[model samples]
Target: MDTMRDRFAPVVSQVLDEDPRVAVVLAEIGAADFQETARRHPDRVVNVGIREQLLVGAGAGLALTGMRPVLHTFASFLVERPFEQVKLDLGHQGLGAVLVSAAASFDWPAGGFTHMAPGDVALLDTLDGWTVHVPGHPDEAETLLRHAIAAGDDRVYVRLSLQANRAGHPVDGKRPLTVREGRSGVVVAVGPMLDAVLAATEGLDVSVLYTTTVRPFDTAALRRATASAGTDVVLVEPYLAGTSTAVVNDALADLPHRVLGLGVGRGELRRYGTLEEHVAAHGLDAGSLRERISAFLARRDAVPAAS
Candidate 1:
């Protein structure tokens, strides 16, 4: 099966061929993949070499000229290094651009710490009006990419990753899809973390809510799930742990609830290991998630109900 990043070039290429107003800006990361596309649309596809800031600036410039720009690079450089350009050129200017990032979190551990970007989503969260999509499968990635492109002058970020689930879930880019129903609690799995979350919550009486769209978070769906199941939630993300905990808290502020945010921890793992090893070390594996989720739910269940 092709990874989300693997599916990005073809989808963008097709969009470029179909839409005249669409432009792609690259920072020398995945330029090779778009060599043919660049040749086809010399004016639309642009490569700004190793300059990450220039890549974002050029995309913003394109957006300013009434063209929808899609920017691509590794997450570390795309969002982290060029964050000022993103904040000023895009956000402050109120321009729309599809920022597509590859090598999510720890996809390229061998490339060392510089390539990892577990806080990309969290960083974007600090800014306002940014739509974020974290697709679990390549199909979902394609869907979200198309959705972002047609979003019409809205700031959008489509996070691509080498990690993916066994199958793609139906994503409408509006609300969360309920994967399983139960009365205990709700496990909200984001992006590539769905499979581990499902495996962890198996045989448990917890509802599973899957979503590729994180920004403009589905508060309604979450409220509905929590209303049926008790006010307990476990957010399992592929990025930094507790990244969405604040949003979850605000969403459930009216009701008394317990939320356990699970994902990549902030602690840096100096060792360059396999992806599976990193997952295990971060306690994001199925067994670890199960233990943590079960424990948190057990504690919540132990609490006496208000009379």
Candidate 2:
């Protein structure tokens, strides 16, 4: 299923075909790299040159004209070149458009840092009214894409990773479910890191909450999940420690919550390797998570119960 391009391609094509009023713009730098569906639906797909800023600005213009635009490009180019357009035209103007970012995170390893986007999450996460959804699987991708197409939200950003196989299930926009629940401690897991968190918490009392939607995170559910746990809830995200992560940590200020941020680390990831290797290096793998969880539990136990 790794190279199954035909699988999700048709789903995206079908959506573009169904919506006659909206425009689906796709901009790719190289040949043989464009989306199959966007190619199939040629009328809707907009092929701007290698310039990503113009691509996003054009999408914003389309959105201003009452046409819902879906901006498609690699996560690296989408956020890098079009920072002003995305932040001003779409975000500031409150255009109801969606940015479909591909190769999110280490999705493209052989392509090097220019291709890999292990930092896109932290970028869009900072934008106001920008909803970032990273579908862990193809089914989740299809469902989330459909929702974004129909949603009237101000702006939407969907990040697609190489580990899309683990996206699990398609959550309803109305009622998002709790993927995993624990008692003693709550681990707010996102992206493919859930695999690590889940494996580590085996036979443990910690609860794992996998968030598919970042902006509209189920705060109500989070509050309910951490209600009984009290001081054991830990807010974790794949982004390095920053405003977005800090805001999340601060959100649970009322309840004693510890934030364990997992990301590509503070400095540039100078080492070139596979995603697994990167995860191992960054201590986001199952083994590292287990050790961290064990240490956290030990520290908690060290503190005596109320007298």
Best-performing candidate as measured by TM-score:
1
Error of 2 at 251 (Å): 2.7
What tens-digit string does per-residue lDDT give for candidate 2 at 123-154? 77667777777665666667777788788745
Q: To one decimal, what is the Cα RMSD in angstroms of model 1 from the true structure?
A: 2.7
lDDT of 1 at 88: 99
Task: Give the per-residue Cα lDDT of candidate 2 at 170.
Answer: 52
**Which ten-residue region of model 1 has the weakest summed lDDT?**
298-307
- Candidate 1 CA-lDDT value: 0.92
User: Residue 294 CA error for candidate 2 (Å)?
Assistant: 2.2
Local distance difference test, each candidate: 0.92, 0.66
- In the range 87-131, model 1's lDDT, one tens digit per residue, is 999999999999999999999999999999999999999999999
